[model samples]
Target: MNKKDSIKACGRTINYEIVYSKKRNKASIVISPDLKVEFRAPHGISSETIRKMVSEKAEWIQKKLEWFEVNRLPDHKKQYCEGEIYLYLGREYPLKIIAFDDVKEPIVSVKDSELNFVVPKKDSEDTLPLLIKKAVWNFYSKRAEEEVEKVLKVYSKKLGIAPPTFKVKHQKRRWGSCSADNVLRINFQLVMAPPEQLEYVVVHELCHVIEKNHSARFWKLVKQMMPDYEEYRKSLKKEGWKYML
Candidate 1:
């Protein structure tokens, strides 16, 4: 079952939806890439309880909404041109294009302080940028999967929860999301941030598998897993530009 509603957070009105699930043991809030807030709760959960939960998380929700509103971009300097800057792990890496005759397909790699793109001189001249873009996307997507797996292993063990299943994808507004089944969807762009930022997002989603809401207990679990999470959270908020596809 599903129903729509609205509430005020940080003196601003926020529209949301409630999705009822008979199999769900706890309630969770998922903010989509379009900034649509959703509440997934058990069939017997009350509207007042959900509303109170939303109200309790008003500040964080408002900040996320505002960040999404401010950070939407159609293009992010991904021209794949020579010397153009790209980020990896919160550091800058300049683009270096190498044209070779034997190269049949685009290949991208990070060597030292540059993102090396190798391409064929004949076939890919017209579609060089697109090829480079795809290569870069694959690069980050693979690294994101690895990073999520590694982080979840260490942190989930500390939190005493088995490593939950996760996926890496491109999302415009969200860093990561925790689904009702304890599955996590991590944004691939997140691999560009510093290591601590990635850990914070992973830990935040992992905590949701237990607490399910942004209540005090959920935050406490996050803190337990990452004692300096607040610093990384604030830094991520300020470095929001680094999280781009």
Candidate 2:
């Protein structure tokens, strides 16, 4: 079951959703990327108990909400049209939409400091945005494939370990993760970030193969690989949302 509720925190009433699940053994609270708060609790948990738990976690929840507020992507209702700026490798480039009569599918390319979108003339203005979004995704996915592979190869060789298979996809809450089988999954949105930031994420996840947790030893390995990793990591938190299309 799902229900909407609100809790008082920091002299304000913060709205949230409650989900009751049989699979859950305890209560868990999460602040979504969009700043929506959610609480999942096991069956038979009382509302008062849940409210008390939320009160206990009120400070932490407020901190997360503030972080999201500061880091959220500006212009969430951005229309994919000409003159709109997009990020590539930490640089902003204006988008140029070019309608072509003979083009069968949307094609996106970067040339001379501009992102060009070649779309069929038959597509309506409403449909053009969707097509442009698809084109942009394709462009990022291709770059992710090339750039992530190169970084992984270099780091794997330096670390003297077999490189794990990696793939890029959309992720809501994580930059990258290492699976139990040692496979690496990178967020393709990161392709828009600077190369150094991308490399930092790669090395951080690669260190997970040696140490599964973010303990001192795991961070030690990460520092050994990239001495400036902490700076890059903080930058990811501060300005990473600019890359989200």
lDDT winner: 2
Task: Give the Å error, residue 124, model 1.
Answer: 3.8
lDDT string for model 2 (1-245, tens) is 78888887898888888889664667899886688898988889888888888889999999999998998745655588899988888888899999889999999988989999999999999888888988899999999889999999999998999889999999966799888789999999898899999999999999989888768999999999999999999998877767777
Lowest summed-lDDT stretch of 10 residues in model 1?
Answer: 71-80
User: For model 1, what is the error of residue 101's alpha carbon versus the real structure, in angstroms, after optimal superposition?
Assistant: 1.8
For model 1, how does the per-residue alpha-carbon lDDT over 107-146 read when each residue is reduced to its tens digit? 8888978989888888546687788889899999998899
List ranges where model 2 is wrong by over 4 Å: 1-12, 16-34, 38-53, 57-73
| Cα-based lDDT for every prediction | 0.86, 0.88
Q: For residue 209, what is the lDDT in candidate 1?
A: 94
Q: Model 1 scores what on Cα lDDT?
A: 0.86
Model 2 / residue 69 / CA error / Å: 7.0
TM-score for each model = 0.71, 0.80
